[model samples]
Target: MYVINKSRHSAYLLHAHIVFVTKYRRNVLGDLHLDAFKTSAAEVCAEFDAELRECDGESDHVHLLIEYNPKVQLTKLVNSLKAVTSRRLRNQFTDLRAAYDKPVLWSRSYFVGSCGGAPLEVVAQYVRNQRG
Candidate 1:
């Protein structure tokens, strides 16, 4: 059930599993916060011609599965997602903003894993068996 994307010259499929943790590992997110994050994440992914396949989280961290185009720079997308979500959440929930002196929601670092591709060993074996 993987659909390949075609550009003017190339075809590819790319996905990223990203994780963001709350600043100081605070347990501030609840149902309302998670819902808002999902909505905002979908909108942000749309801007980059990507799709947010799934999103879920606990009180302290969130996870997102995104299918995206190869042209998108992973780092920039992650930064934007964090910044936009943080700003929106802080504005929507005054109590959340009050918990921090500075405007911060997610920690500075994040986890991003590339997914949806042939296994590494399989690809390597194929290359080794190449005629030329």
Candidate 2:
């Protein structure tokens, strides 16, 4: 079930699922890296007044489910998440830093999908049935 959240002026429910792949799709992440990433990601989300609801990953990629206010600019949040995580992870993990001569962690691209609330088709049908 989705819960409605509120700010001083509005109430809303918004969520997004995001996926970030390692640069070159490298399988460099281990348990420690994944843990650190969760921590780092949660902090970043909090900075944007969002919540990181869920996070998990494999060696090459990670998934994040974030609940955010409608006012948040997702692209900016994503860029910050990628940049901050890259810098933090590289500095903390020597092997990760050494794994690449170039200073890079995640790829330049990412996947993001809006989620939660009613399905699009369901909402569309409801709208079509409206008397007005």
| Candidate 1 residue-wise lDDT at 70 | 84
> Model 1, 83-113: lDDT tens per residue?
9999999999998898798999999989999
Give the alpha carbon lDDT tens digit for every residue of 2-100 in model 2.
779888999999999999999999999999999999999999999999999999999999999999998899999999999999999999999999888
Q: Which pairs clash in model 2?
A: none
Deviation of model 1 at 95, angstroms: 2.1
Cα-based lDDT at residue 2, candidate 2: 73
TM-scores of all candidate predictions against the true structure: 0.94, 0.95
User: lDDT, candidate 2, residue 27?
Assistant: 98
Q: Which residue segments of model 1 deviate by more than 4 Å?
A: none
RMSD of 1: 1.2
Lowest summed lDDT across 10 adjacent residues in model 1 is found at 114-123
